[model samples]
Target: MLKFFYEEIDFKVPQSLKTSKWLKNISLSEGYKLGDLNYIFCSDDYLLEINKQYLEHDYYTDIITFDNSEEEGKLEGDIYVSIDRVKDNAINIGVSFDIELRRVLVHGLLHLIGFEDSDDDLKQQMRAKEDECLLLY
Candidate 1:
């Protein structure tokens, strides 16, 4: 089962498998499996602190993930999503709240299963994967 915790925020959004399906599909494509995942939605301030404390990043981001799965194929992680950033990104990308939310969710899942966008090529690939995951909806 997918579970989500709210930290520094109060949102009514439920854990969605339509979202989880995208993660599970990507994991399957890469020979990974989906395990129990914990998504924590929070505010910009909270996530910014997480970024600074864990990644040395002192800026706000849409999401942060920590993979805890010991099994190679099984996916597990603590995903911290910043709803504030998601909303802002939605505006910037011209998508609805749901679309941007799914993109951010997929982005975190991709990280748990080994996906990065630190370089130009990787960024392109990540964007491609994000779009592909969106198609699963």
Candidate 2:
């Protein structure tokens, strides 16, 4: 199940982005199963604040994942995403909005699956895993 928690207002995500088996597939690709997954959609300003306050960085990022998996074993976390950034990225990448959105969504899920991208070397690996998971869609 995917429940959205808005950091700003009660905005609704498009019905197209609702919970799916694809998300479950992402969880399984990492040798895990999702009991519940939560996503948080916010504006660039809102997410920037979270990035600064929680991560101690002061720049805009595409997405941030909060791992809440505990003894309960649910793939719990808050996927903070900026729609404004997604729009620009879709335009720059020359992909449709839905495709770009799915990329970002999967990116955050990949992070929960032990995929790290803290440096240049690992970024490539992360991208590979992302692309690998992209095959499902």
Tens-digit lDDT track of model 1 for 1-137 = 46778898978564565666666776788787778888899999999999999999999999988988888778887999999999999999899988898888888888887889889999899989889978877
Regions of model 2 farther than 4 Å from truth: 7-19, 72-74
**CA deviation > 4 Å runs, candidate 1:** 14-17
The lDDT per prediction is 0.85, 0.79
lDDT (Cα, 0-100) at 81 in candidate 1: 95
Q: Mind giving the per-residue lDDT tens digits that candidate 2 earns over 84-119?
A: 888889999898877777888889888877779989
- What TM-scores do the predictions have? 0.89, 0.85
Residue 132 in model 1: lDDT: 91
- Judged by lDDT against the true structure, how good is candidate 1? 0.85
Q: How high is the lDDT of residue 111 in model 1?
A: 85
Residue 67 displacement (Å), model 2: 1.0
